[model samples]
Target: MRYHVLCGIVVSGLLFGSAHPAFAAGPVRLPSAATVSSGAAAAASVPQQLVKITDVTNIRQTPSLDAPVVKKAQPGQTYAIVETVAGPGGDWHKVVLGEDKTAYVASWVVETAENKPGKSSTGQEKPSTGGKQPEPSRTILNIIDVTNVRAEPDLESAVVAKAQPGQTYTATGTEGAWYKVSMANGKTAYIASWVVTATTLSGSAGQSAGQSAGGQVFIYHTHNRESWKNVAGSKSGSSVDDAKTNITLVGQELGRVLQQKGVPAITANDDIAGRLVLKNLSFTQSYSESRKTILEAKNTNPALSYLFDIHRDADVPRSQTTVTINGKAYARIMFVVGTGNPGYEDNAVFAETLKELLEKKYPGLSRGILVKSAHQGNGEYNQSLSPTSLLLEFGGVNNTLEENKRTAAAFADVFADYYASVQSKSK
Candidate 1:
C-alpha cells in the first residue's frame, strides 16, 4: 500500500509532446446541483500544481527552452498548490516539483486545478505563535568502543557527560560534536559534539564503495522474495527486504578472516539457528520490525561484538550497475543512519568506524552514510537496537542480479578482514 503511494507520486512538472492523441476522452460529471457554501478555502495553504502534456517531461536546468536537462518526469507531473506566472514565450508556467528532489518546471503545458480562494489574513504573524514544539525522538548507538559527551565544540572542552560504545542518548541538533539538546528535564542544554557521533542527513551525497576484502557486494534479491510476500522490487527486482542478510554474511566472513590470521574464530547464521549468542537484545522498527525472522538465525550463532543489517537501494541508474575486476565500476554501497532514536551519536560512530575500515580496504567502493528520513526505510531501520548496528544499502534496483550477488560475497570477505583487525586491537 505504501509503495503504491510512492509509485503514484509525480516527481516533477514538465511536459514535452502529448502522450495520447487527446486530453479529454471521458464525459465530465458535476457536483450535486444543490450544494451548501462552506467558509473554508477550497485548497489548503500548501502549494499545488499539475503537468500539461499527456506524456512525461524532463525538468530542465534553466527556465528557458534551451536550458540543460536534469531529470525526467512521468505523465501527469504533480506540482505544488500555488500560482505560477507564465514563463518567457512558452505557454508553460514555471514551477518547482518533486519531494526527494525539488527540480523546477514550466507551467504552459500543465494546468492548475481551480484553487478555492483564501481570504486575506495577516502574513507577518505566525512563526512566533507556536512555542516550544515537542522534542524529537532519540536513538541508541551500539558497537562503539569509547565516546564522551563534552560541554564545548572542541575536544578540549570539559566532559559534561560520558557515553560507552554501546550507550544510548537523545540526539537533538548539532554544531560539530556540540549538540543543542534537551536534558532529562524539560529544558534544552548544550552538549559536547565529540560526545556523540553525528548521523548523515537526508539527500546528502553517498559514499563511494572501494575494495577491501570485498570491492563490491550485493544481497540476493530472491532472498526477500522467497521470504516476504511482494516486498521485493517489482520494477528493479534487486532490493533486499532488510539487513539480516548482510549481518549473516558478515558473521560468516569474520570467522574465515579470523582463521586466516590464526585467531581460531567460528561463525554461523544468527537468525535461523537461535543459539542465544546474545540474550534478549533487539533493534527497533527504524531498524526493521520484521527482523523477528532473524530469530531463527540468532538461535544458532556465537556472541558478536557488532550486529549489521545489510540491504540495497531501488530506482537506481543502470550506469551504476557495472562491475569490473580491476579499475572498473562494479557496485556501490550506501551507509544509513537514523536520527529519530536515542542512540544517534553512538550509531553514527559505528557507521563511521565501518566506513573508515571499508574505505581503507576497498578504496572507493563504499558509499558514505545516508541520513534516513523518519518517514521511510524502517525509520532508523534497526540501528536503535545496538551501538554496533547499521543498515547498509548495497546498490540500486537496476543493478544486475549476479553483480549484486557477487558484491555480497565480496562484502563477506571485507567483514572477515574487519573482524581480524578488531580482534587484534582488543588484544
Candidate 2:
C-alpha cells in the first residue's frame, strides 16, 4: 500500500522540477521508524506560526496531492501555520484558509517566519497573554548511530521515533546519558546521548564490506518487474513486466561480467512480482515468492552461497537516477540489509564490502548501506540463508534500461575483484 503511494506524486509549486519530484526533495519514507534527526524541524509549527506564500499553490484538505484542493493560495499572502506533516507525497503545511476553514500547502510554496527567533502576530491582535516559563536552552546533536527516540529518557519506555544516522536533533534538556529532543508536532522524545556524536554529521560515503567471497553466488530480484524504456535508443515503451525485458537484463549483465571474471554466477529470472498475482496476494508477498526460488537453487547446489537481489528504486525522483562517473552515465545503487534475521552481521559485511569495492573503483556508485530491521519490510529476504545475501536497488523508474545496464557492468567489474579475492582466500 505504501509503495503504491510512492509510485508517483505531483504537487504544485515544487522546489525541484515540475515533471517529477527529486528523491532528495522529499522525506525518506520507510515501512516503520527509519531515522530522522530533524524530526522537530520536519513538521510545521504547533501553535499557529505566521508565514507568507511565495508561489501560487493549491490548498489541499490533506497532506497528499491525492487530497482535494480547497482553494488556490496567492503569492505574498500571509497565513498562520496550524500543523505540518512530512507525508509520502512531500511536506505539507496546514494553514488557515478563512475565519473558520483551513487547508494545507506544500512546504516549498511558503516562507515560514518560524525560521526566526520568535513568533509573528496578526494585525487584529488580542489582549496580552499570561507570562510563560522560558524554554530550556537547546543543543543540536548529530546522531552517530541508528538510535531510537524514546517516549521517556529511560530505555524501558516506548520508542516514539528513530534518530537516523547523520540526522541532527535539537535537544532541550538531559537526564543522565539521555537527551530530550523536541519534535515539529510539539511532542518531546528522548535519545541516548551516547549514541549521538557531538560535533558533525556523517558524509555521503559508505563503510567497508569486510569478508572473503564464499561459494558460487546466486543472483535474483524480488522486485523483478522493475524495468525501463525509451533510453536504449528505443523510440517507444518503458519497463516490461517480464524478466527478459526489465531488471532481469541488468542481473544478466552482472552475471555475464562475473562469468567473464571466472566467477560462476546464476541469474534466477523468476517473475517474483508475478507470483503474487498467481497467489492473489499483495505485493509484499514478493519476497516470500522469491525466497522459494532461492531455497530451491541452494538445495540443488550448495555452491550457491552469495546472493544478490537487484531492482530499481521508485522512492527517489528520476533526476537523481543518473550519476556520471568519468563522464559516463550509470545508475546509483543502494544496498539494503534487514537486521531481523540471524545473519545480519555477515550480510552487512558483505554489503559493505561490495559498496567499498564499488566506490573504490567507480566512486559515487554506491549510496551507502542502509540497514533495515524486522520492524521494517521485515521479510528475511531469505538472506539469512546465506551470509553474503544482499538486496540492491539500482536507479529508479525514471532510469532507462540501458542506463541500468551500464551500472550493472560497472557493478560486475567491482564484484569480480571481490569474488576473486574471496576465492584466493578460500583456496
Candidate 3:
C-alpha cells in the first residue's frame, strides 16, 4: 500500500516536474540530444569557437557517463569546440580530439574562451575587434535572476518582457554584455548578460542518473540474449543480439525499480556473445565478455556500490520456476554467490541479506542463495571489485516478461528496505 502511494508520487512528480533552470535563464529546456545530435553545416561568419577548461575533466566518446572515456582534459587548457549537445546528463561540449575525431566534455568544467571581452586593462573595447564582436552561437542560457528583456540590445530600449530566473532560452546572437532571445509572441528581446549563465539544457547535469547522489548500482546481463517463449523475441540460440526483448529488459526493469526506490542505477547492454565469438571463446566464457563492462561502469561511476548480473535460468519446467501471488504470476528469483575471490564472503553476505529480505516480504519469492566454487565456472565473477555484487537468476527460459517484471518490482522494494537500513547504520 505504501509502495503504490510512493509510485503515485514519483509518477506525478515526473509528470509535473519542471527542469532545474539550466542556471539563470527561465526553467526551460533546449533541444534534447536525440533531436539535436547534429548541427547546421553552414559555417558562421568568423565564429569564435574555443572552450577553456577550468578544471581537470574527462573527455568522453558520447555525452553519457556510460560511454567510454576518450581522453583526459588538463586544467587551464583551451580546445576548439566542434558542437554542443543537450544530453541526458547535461550540456556536453563536443570538441576536437584529433584530426577528425571528437570527444565530449562537461560544460561545467569549461568556459567559453570566445566570451572574453574586447576590453583591455582599461574599460574600453579593443580596436582589434573593430569595437563590435561577432554574434554568438544558438546555444542556450539559463536566467539566474529576474531580468528585463528589452526590445533593443540597449538598456534604454522599452521593456518588452521580464524573464524570471530558472528559465532557458536560445541565444540567437549576442551584443556586448547582452544576449538575444526570441520570444514566443514573435518579438525579439535582449537579456542582459549579468543575470544569466550560459549552458545547454540536459538531463544529466546536476541530476542523479537513476537512484541517488553518490550511490550508483550497476545492472547487467552476462547471457544477454537469453530469451523466453513469447517473451524471448531474439535469436533462437542461447545468446541474442537484440536488446529489446532479451535478458537486457529484465536488467532494465531491475534498474527502473531501483531508481523508483531512489537508488541511482544503470543497466549495461554490451554484446557479450558477440565479443565471445570474436575472441573465439567458448560459450562458457560468457562471463569473461561481461567483465569489461562491469569494470568500465565502475571506472566511470566510482560510487557504484551494488552490482547485479541479472540473467534467466535454464529450468525447463515453467511450473517449477513460476510463483503465483495476488492472482498474478511472477518469476522466482535466485542468488548465486562466487567463493573464489578475496571478497567472496562479502558477496555471499550480500546475497544472503537480499534473499532474506525478499523472503520476508513475499515468502518463497527467492530460491535461497547458492554458493559456487571455481569448479562451477567463473566462480570469481569479478565479485572482487565490490563486495556487494551478486549473480541474480530471474525465472527460467520458460518464464514471460510479465512474470519477470513483477518479481523485479518486488525485489526492488526489498532492496529499498535494505538500503534504508544501511543508510541508518552509516549515519
Candidate 4:
C-alpha cells in the first residue's frame, strides 16, 4: 500500500515484463546520508600538505597509487591534505579522506589556503588588473559573420546576445578570445575574437568565416544535497537526506555515462569548486544563489551552444517511482523546462526537438517533458544560455540507485545520436 501514494509514476506493461529480474528490486531499506561521504567536503578539510592537480576528474583513493586506478571522483570529488611542497615539482603529501579511505593528490591540485579551512580569504585577494590598464575604450570594428554574447566567462552559461558580421562595435575588453564590445545601440555585447578580424587589422588577419569554429557544448551538474534535505516519503519513511544521497549518485552516474559516450562537455572540478561555480549546492542555492554564480562563470567560456543542468526529482509514490528498462529496473530520464526566462520559447522548442528525436530512437525511457511554470524558484534554471538549455531530472528519489546509473547510460547514447543528427544536417 506504500506504493499507492505515487502521483507521478505511470503504469505501463513495458516497464516490467515476465522476467522480473532480481536486480530490479532494491535494498530492503534506502540508504542514509551518514553512509555516503563527499570527497569535496573531505578535500576542503585536509591538512596543509597535499595539492589538487586536475581541473576535473580528480580521484580519491585508499592507500595511494604510484599511478592509481581511479575508482570514483567525478566532478565535485576531493581529497584531504597531509603534507606540502615548495615549488612546481613539489613533493606529494598523503592523508585519509573518509572512513577507511586514503589517497594522495598532486601537490599542485590543491590550494594552499584551504589547509586553514573555514577562514575567510576574501580580504587577502589580489587587486584587479583591469583597474591598472588605460581607460575602458574601443574603436568601432566590423562584426564577424557569427558570434555570441554570453552571461558568463564560459560557454555553458546563458547567452544574452549574438553578433553578426558587418555589425560594427567598439572593443571594450578581452577575456581570453572573447571580446566585450560596445554595440551600435550603445549596449555592450561580446563576440568570439576568432570569428571576427579587427577592421583596423584588415588584410593582416583575414580569415574566411566558413573556417569559424562551431558553437561549443557546455554541461553542468547541479548536485543539490539540500533539495532532498527535508523531503520525506509519503509511504516510505525515507528522509530528504536519504533522497539527496541518491541524487548525488545520479549525478555521478550521469557523468560516467557522458564520459563513456565520449560526449564533449565540461564538468566542474573540486579545486575550482565554489557553491556558484564548481562545487555542488542545495536545490535552494542552485535556483537562487547559483543563478548569479553560473552567470559569472559562463562569462569565462564563451563558445557554448547547449547547456544541461542535471538534477533528480522526488515526491511520488513507490510504484510510480520505480523505473524499469529492458526488463531491468532503471531510473527514468525527465527533461524539464521552466517557463520563466526570456528564452522559454526557444528552450521549449529545443526540448521538444530533443524529445522528438529521442522518442523516435529510444522511446519510453524519456518520461516526456515536464514544464514547471509557477513553482520553479528563479524560473530560468539557466536555460537562457541557449535555446537548447534544459534541466534534466534522472529519476525520483524513491528509485533505486542502480536504476539511475543505467538511465544515465541510456541517455548518453540518445544524446550522442542527437549530436550526430545535428552534425549531419549542419553539413
Comparing 1 and 3 on lDDT, the stronger one: 3
| Candidate 2 residue-wise lDDT, 296-365, digit = tens | 6654344567789887876477666678888777889999898877768899888888898898899888
lDDT of each: 0.41, 0.62, 0.63, 0.47
Extract clashing residue pairs from model 2.
23-317, 35-164, 40-184, 209-352, 209-353
Q: Compared with the true structure, what per-residue lDDT tens digits does model 3 show for residues 242-321?
A: 45677788777776666556565666767797788789999888877788777755543455668888988884588878
> What C-alpha RMSD separates each model from the true structure?
22.3, 23.0, 18.3, 18.9
State in Å the error of residue 383, model 4: 1.6
For model 4, the local distance difference test gives: 0.47
lDDT score for residue 350 of model 2:
84
- Which of the two candidates, 3 or 4, achieves a greater lDDT against the reference? 3
Q: lDDT for model 3, please.
A: 0.63
Candidate 1, lDDT over the whole model: 0.41
**Candidate that beats the other on TM-score, 1 or 3, i.e. the better one:** 3
Off by over 4 Å in 4: 1-214, 221-223, 226-239, 242-246, 269-285, 375-377
Highest-scoring model, TM-score = 3
The TM-score of candidate 2 is: 0.47
Candidate 3 vs. true structure, TM-score = 0.52
TM-score for each predicted model, relative to the true structure: 0.36, 0.47, 0.52, 0.47
